[model samples]
Structures are given as C-alpha cells and as structure tokens.
Target: MTPMIEIDEVTKYFGTKLVLDRVSLTVNRHEVVCLIGASGSGKSTLLRCVNRLVAHDYGTIRLDGVPVDDPRFGKTGLQKRAGIVFQSYNLFPHMTVLENITLAPRRVHGVSRAEATARAQEVLARFGMDGFAQAYPEQLSGGQQQRVAIARALMTKPDVLLLDEITAALDPELVGEVLAIIRGLKDAGMTMMIVTHEMGFARDCADRVAFLSDGMILEEGPPDRIFGAPEQPRTRAFLDRIIASGRL
Candidate 1:
C-alpha cells in the first residue's frame, strides 16, 4: 500500500543554517508516528514541509502519493489534506470558539454556515469541549484553546494531522487534557505525525518513534527498541538526558 506521507532525502535550510538534512521517512495510513528529538533537531521543520507550510529546499515530499509542491496540489488543497496545530494556540482572539472552528470550513471549504456549525459542534463534543462553543480564546484555558485548535483542524476532515509541540505552551496540569484528546484521535485511527518532547507520552502513544539529531533521523523503531535500548550512542545519550530530567 502506498504510504500516506513520504519524504525522500528532503533537505531544508534557513539562510546559512541547515534545518533538515537529507531526511526521509514514511507514515502509513492510520499510523501514528511520533518524532522525539532535542530542540532544533528539525522535527517541526519536517512537519511544516509535509504540510507545505514551508517549501523544501531539495528532495520531495508526497502526501497520498502526490507531490506536495506540484502546481496542481495548491496550498489550500494541501492545507485541507493535512491539518496542523501548533504549541501556541493560534486561534483568532476576536472570534468565539464556534466561529473559530467553523471559519475555515465555511470559507475555504465552501461549507455552509449551518453545516460548518454542525460539524464544529460534533467535533467539539468529541474532544470534550462541548460547552465552549461561545467562549473566546482568552476565556478558555490553554488546554481548552488547544483542543479548540485541534477540533477546528478536524472540522476540515483532514487526511493527516500534524501536531507541533502542542503541549509546549500549556500548564503542567492542563497537558493531560490535550494529550487525552490526542490519544482519542489515535484510537480513532487518525493518521498523524507529532513532534513532542514528552518521552513518556511518546512511548505510550506512538506506533513508531523516531529520534532525530542534527537534522537527521539518528534512529527510529518500535517504541520498545527506541526507548528501552536505543542503538545509536547519540540516541542513548539523548534518552539518558531525558531520564535524567525524569521525562522517560
């Protein structure tokens, strides 16, 4: 079967610095792949390239077998196919939760207001944000706003979801709520590529775990192998740090 996401020797740079260096990986349908790496390891950059948030400098990224940079693919089409959520809740502060969730569906997807609203309500209820329809971004907790962002992404019925350090901005007590929602997504067989620093969460939730260092995937395997006995010395050192920090 064709993979849902494929990256082939992809490389990216920001001015003089290389962010992703000849990286390649695949995520099959209904698979949850977690990227576990220290800061500046190109985790978020890879996801952005997948979703076409930033164009890759070399190599190719394909989604559902189509090149992401192909002219026919189009930005809106790519955005619709791969919904993304970030660490900072990117909700429009002036909009209510319902409006925020429904805006893209109604505008970009050409969904009617009533239809968009119904979809929003259903996904919000699914994510345990049922009563937050009228709340503004500032009024909700960080976790709730993040949930709203995820729900909004789901509203578009994306083929793949990209999450970039989504819990990085949340309070310790609030992290579980958002992670619980992600676990629920995994249970529902959503195809996902997540960048996260939470090792325990990565171990418990990822179908496969990849450890990246210096813009390359140093090692990737089943969670047990990658976490219990990382082969690469670099991976071992990183996990040792994670253990020292009491995260693993």
Candidate 2:
C-alpha cells in the first residue's frame, strides 16, 4: 500500500546553518508516528515540511505518493490533505469558537455557512467543546483554546494530522485535557505525525517512535524497543537525558 506521507532525502538549510540533512521517513494510513528529540533537533521542522508550512531545500515530499509541491495540488489542496496544530493556539481573538472552527471550510472549501456550522457543532461536540461554541478565545483557558484549535483543524476532515508540541503552552494541570483529546484521536485511528518532547506520552501514543539527532533520524522502531533498548548510541544518550530530567 502507498504510504500516506513520504519524505525522501529531504534537506533544508536556514542560510549557512543546516537544520535538516538528508532526512527521510514515511507515515502510513491509520498509523501514529512520533518524532522525539531535543529542541533544535529538526523534529518540528520536519513536521512543518510535511504540512507544507515550510518548504524543503532538497529532495521530494509526497502525499500518498503524489508530489506535495505539485502545481496541480495548490496550497489549499495541500492544506486540506494535512491538518496541523501548533504549540501555540492560533485562533483569531475576535472570533468565537464556532466561527474559528468553521472559517476555513466556509471560506476555502466554499461550504455554505449553515453546513459549515453544522459540521463545526458536530466536531466540537465530539471533542467535548460543545458548550463553548459561542465562547471567545479570551473566555477559555489555554487548554480549551488548544482544543478548539484541534477542532478547527479537524473541520477540514484532513487525511493526515500533524501535531507540534501541542501541550507545550499549557500549564501542567491543563496538559492532560489536551492529551486526552489526542489520545481519543489515536483511538479513532487518525493517521498522525506528532513532534513532541513528552517521552512517556510518545511511548504510549506512538505506533512507531523515531529518534532524531543532528537533523537526521538516527533510529526508529516500535516504541517498546526504542524506549527500552535503543540500538544507536545517540538514541540512548537522548533517552538518558530525558530520564535524567525526570521526564521519562
């Protein structure tokens, strides 16, 4: 079967500084793949590349084996296939939760307002934000805003979801609520590529965990092996640091 997303020898550089060096990975349908590494390890950059939020300097990225940058795909088409939620909630401050969630579908996809609203209501209800549809961003906590952001992404009914440090901005107490929604998505078989610093969460949620070091994926395997018995020295060193920080 064709992979849902494929990255082949993708290289990216920020001026003289190289951020990604011949990196490659594949994400299959209904599979949850987690990218685990320290900050500046290029995990987040890889996620951005997959969603076309940023472009790679070399190599090709494919969605279901079709080139991601193909002119025919267009920007809107690429976004529709892959939905991404960032660490910071990017909702418009003036828009209510319902309006925020329905904006893309109504404007980009050309769905009628009534239909977009119904779809928003359905996803918001599913994600336990039904009561807050009319609430403004200021009225909700960080966790609630992040949840709304995730709901808005799902409104597009994307084929793949990319989550980048989604719980990073939340207070410790608020983290679980956001994580629970993600857990629910995994249970529902949402094909996802997640870049996260939470080792325990990565172990629990990932079908496969990839250890990236110095802009390359040094090792990848089932979470059990990657966590319990990493083969590469770099992978083990990274995990050692996580354990030392009491984050594992």
Candidate 3:
C-alpha cells in the first residue's frame, strides 16, 4: 500500500541557519504520528513543508507517492489534498459556526451552499458541536472554537490532517473534550500528524512517536519503545527534564 505522506532527505534552512537536517519519515493511511521535542526542533517546519506552507530548500516530499514539492504538484493537482488546524483557532469571528465551516467548501471546492451546509452539519454532529452551528466564534469557548476549526478543516474532506498544538491554549478543564474529539478521529482512521506536548494523549493516540532535537530526529519508534525505553541519551535526557520539572 502506498504511504499517505513521505519525506526523504528533507532539509530546510532559514538564512544560513539550518532548521531541518536531512529529516525523513513516512506516515501510512489511518496512522497517527506524534512529533515531540523542545521548541525550534523543526517539527512545525516539517509539518509546514508537507503542505507547502513553508517550501523546503532541499529534498523531496511525496503525498501518496506523488512528489508534492515539485511545481507540478500545483499544476497537476494537490492543493486540496491536505488540511491544517493551527494552535489558535483561526476562525472568522463574524461568521456563524456553520458559515465558517461552509465558506471554503463553497468557495474553493464549488460545493453549493446547501450541500456544504449538509456536510457541515454532519461534521459538526460528529464533532459534538452541532448545537453551536448558529453561534459565532466569540460566543464559544476556546475548546469549542478549536472543535469548530477541526470541523472546518474536515469540511474539505482531506486525506491527511495536520494538527499543530490544537489544545495548547485551552483551559486545563477544557483539554479533555478536544482530545476526546481527536481520539474519535483516530478511532475512525483519520491519517494525522500531530505536534503536541500532551504526552499521555500522544502515547494513547499515536501509532509511532518521534523525538526531534535541535534540527534532527534523535529518536523514533513505536509509542511503547519511544515512551517506555527511549534509545537515545538526548531522548532520555529530554524526558528526564520534563519529568523533573513536573511539566510532563
């Protein structure tokens, strides 16, 4: 079976400073991969490269074995192949929940308003946010807004979903609800790449876990191996500091 996403010898540089050093990985369909590391580890950069949000300076990225970084990717067709959800819920505050979810589908995909609404309603129901369809972003809580953001991304019916710290800004009490929604997506076989600090959720939801350090992948393995018995000194040290600091 073809992998959903593949990165090979990928390197990204900002000025003379290199951020990603020949990093490579593969994510299969229905699989969840978690990227864990300190800030400036290139985890976010790698995510951006997957969708051409930040074009790489070197190396190749293939989506379902089709080279995506090539200019042909856009000329041929790959723009609607993936979806992204950010740390901050980037919602249109002026639009109602349904409107926000329906905008892209209607405009970009040429999905009729009525058809988009139907899909939005189904997605919102799946996200447990159907009750808020008529509500505005400001009227909803942070967790609720993030769920709306997820639903909006799902509105595109993407093959791969990129989540960057989607739960980071939420109140502690509200984290569980968002994580629960993600768990539901995983249970339903959504292919995902998650950059998160929520260790327990990553361990529970990730098929594989990767430890990124500096600009390189210091360790990677099944969750049991990465979390239970990390092979690298950097991995163990990182985990130690997080645990000792009571941040894990």
RMSD of each: 0.9, 1.0, 1.5
Question: For residues 1-248, could you state the per-residue lDDT of candidate 3 as single tens digits?
Answer: 45999999899999999999999999999999999998889999999889988889888999988888666656324656788899899999899999998988888778899999999999999888889999999999999999999999888788999999999999999999999999999999999999998888888889999999988888888998888899999999888887888766
lDDT of 1 at 215: 99
Candidate 1, residues 25-105, lDDT tens digits: the string is 999999999998889999999999998888899999999999998877665888999999999888999999999999998
Residue pairs whose backbone atoms clash in candidate 3:
none
Tens-place lDDT digits, model 2, residues 46-114:
999987789999999999888899987775999988999999999999999999989999899899999
Tell me which of candidates 2 and 3 scores higher on TM-score.
2
TM-score of 1: 0.98
Candidate lDDT scores, in order, read 0.93, 0.92, 0.89
Worst 10 residues of 2 by lDDT: 66-75
Clashes of each: 0, 0, 0
How does model 3 score by TM-score?
Answer: 0.96
Candidate 3 residue 229 Cα shift, in angstroms, is: 1.0
